[model samples]
Target: MNLIEKAASRINQGDALSADTAALRSQASPADEPPHAPLVQRAQARAAEVPVHAEAPSAESEQEIAERHVSRQITIDLERLRAAGMITPDDDKHQLAEEFRLVKRPLITNAVEATSSDRNRNLIMVTSSLPGEGKSFCSLNLAISIAMERDRRVMLVDADVARPSLLGYLGLQAERGLMDLLLDPNLQMSDVLLRTNIDKLSILPAGRGHKHATEFLASESMSNLLDEMANRYPDRIIIFDSPPLLVTSEARELAAHVGQVVMVVESGRTSQDAVKEALRQLEGCDIVNLLMNKGSSTPLDGYGYGYGYGYGYGYGRSGRS
Candidate 1:
């Protein structure tokens, strides 16, 4: 076998060893085991009994790993979302949904119909000038809107390492996600990715926090992870809910890797200078679009909500409507 094949073999072996160790431990009775012996010793004893050249992974072992690595499924509270004026799968006719529909059309077009030169257009980042400007709200709505697409899948990543609110918004508890993937090479994307009851929608939490999160966001591993996320499935759109650009260095570092950015500007709240400086930090990106969120416009529907979209600000603007 070649080096790649050998590596795969070893990984498979390791997985099988892990499964066998668990089985042995579970099967061992309390009277059969010494209480003082470390768990590692028991695992080692089980490993020593196996042949040096073990058989290839069995069908059962593969099934076990598949079951173990399957994404944790979650159910979003549709009623809570509807009550909060957010978009839901069943209520596409709502005004908020209509607004997001307008907001997502150009974004969908950009991702679906991109030229060879367009680098990771499907990997979009959503951020704001400062916190509590409804970036998270916009991020969730945009993700749900895209997930409504017939031909697309959306993965919402909580890249706000400092303050993650996506899980709480969806009424989910803390779990391993993006940070764990960056910190541990053994943790596969399947292990942390959350598969929602919402069709074609997945979520990656911010995972555990690290002091050098800015450096982690800028690392080569992060680049590779982003590449995998962008290219693994051609129909997938990865939306990152990043931190406020002016508030955290991590967002600026993250902006460099994505092809397009949606900077949310709350009407009458975020200062012009803050927006300008935030956009300046994202200068490396090829496509930067502005989203006017939480406006006071009251349409005939009696809902005081509005949104505006700035098509494109960088090269290859012709593709966007």
Candidate 2:
């Protein structure tokens, strides 16, 4: 008999396949080899032992599993951040930290006093007119500053789908995140949301790229996701590191969902015309703030870092928007 016939005959006789059967199969001629059909039938028979409608895991249990998955903490290198002139929780006294403090105040206030009409005030996007203008840097520092709040938590999302840099700044490897969440309805926020060594701070990488990324950002799915992030926790703030307005349509689409926009301008390098064009793209947003980075202002404490803050018309040397 052929291998399939022998195996099926043994199974029908309520006998397990012996080592002899395995040896026989190994030595069998090509024509004597078992077809896959019987093996599939055997698998089906085994699977029939289990009920088709097994009880689903409870919501609480699923949440626990998600929490366990998100508990893997991403440790930010504080020394690296210090050397890069970024904010660290331990260095609240640094000039950059203080500058970010002024930058984050109005954002926090708007988030706290959000009316029903301003439902998404807590969702902020940091962008610039052109590349290399320090939007990512400002986004990182702003998120860190907000995370340092006593009662507030922050989720920093890298929305610059074209080129992701937040993870590089934090010294983290890219993994499944925002794009995955949008593409797969099966993915839970906890499956990709990363907790960090910094208390009250979490991160969502840009995830994989897609050709329709701008469409995805402008989709109803993204709006729903933003709503969930905004209302999930009363004390949480989400910061999006967006693409440059003049360079990509992604930022404008993303701006439609956020209540506030912080446009980072390189003081001397970014011309007034460039800032105006960038601001024009954000005219749909009610709260647009300007942050001037790498300005002509003298370095603070001789640390080679300077910051200046102003409202709609004023521009300073240090970073502010």
Candidate 3:
């Protein structure tokens, strides 16, 4: 019998395949009597257990997906997450809001918790080992988080010269940014810094793309710019959204100036070796912490035939509390 038939027979006999198990075994063989039918049935059976209200398999507009993502953010709660060990009790989102006041409040809590400390490491840079690892998302949230800190000024700089993303993420105008400041060393800091809607938070966007972007960041002007910002705003936190280490040398150069580097690793996508190599490549700054996104599909998985998080099932927020 084919794998699906084998699986069905096994299930009927009260020995079902694990839901979390890999699906590669179910791929149909060339000699199968009905090529894709059995595999489809197996996929259906597996999908039935999850109860997801997914979109039909069809092309979707990018705007629709972006809207859906933004809507999902409203449901994430601090107390619920803390119970799941996703965040600490004291570091819960609500508790953090009380301590810090800033616009786009959720981003701030995500940053503070991921970094795990408020003292010492405030000039933050959020980056990844490679592209599409959620570095921009991490950087934006961190800047928002530091701004939320009561009576603190925060500046979010879009320093990803190669490919700037913060403007698009925030849906902001791409007119002027850090590139302008670098090109015109005489430009006053106030001219380049754009204050966001968030109280006490400012942004220095990637002003304009230039051929010598890497050399610009590596220059003495870069050091002077950072030093000027540091001295000008003593209590404010500066967050630099830099390019991924493996993708470019921007992260290494920026890390040298920042107080701490918070590396973002997409839970399922980021390889352990890539993470180790990224750390090795940029060897000096304090690695503030590692933020594992989409953290652990099943935290209790991998142990052979053992009970899961809550009595062989997942835990609710109430259970977590």
Number of the top-ranking candidate, with TM-score as the measure? 1
Candidate 2 lDDT over residue span 226-248, tens digit each = 88887766777899999999999
Q: Where is the poorest 10-residue window by lDDT in model 2?
A: 24-33
lDDT scores of the candidates, listed in order: 0.71, 0.70, 0.53
Better of 1 and 3 by lDDT: 1
lDDT agreement of model 3 with the native: 0.53
Error of 2 at 286 (Å): 1.1
- The regions of model 2 sitting more than 4 angstroms off are 1-71, 298-321
Q: What TM-score fits each model?
A: 0.74, 0.73, 0.57
Backbone steric clashes in candidate 2, count: 10
Candidate 3 has a TM-score of 0.57
lDDT tens string, model 1, 72-164? 788899897776667899998766677677678778888888888787889999998898777788889899999998878789999998899
Candidate 3 per-residue lDDT over residues 1-321, each given as its tens digit? 632233223323422111111111121000001223444555556546754677554332232222222211211233433442321224535422222222223333333443333322445677778887666755655565665556566778898977888776654567576888889856655555665545556677788999988888889988777766654444566788888899888778888776556666654566656766776665565433354433322344676433212111111111110
For candidate 2, the C-alpha RMSD (Å) to the true structure equals 25.2
Clashing pairs in 2: 289-321, 290-320, 290-321, 291-320, 291-321, 292-320, 295-317, 306-318, 307-318, 308-318
RMSD of each candidate relative to the true structure = 17.9, 25.2, 22.1
| Pairs with steric clashes in candidate 1 | none
Model 3: residue 267 alpha-carbon error in angstroms:
0.2
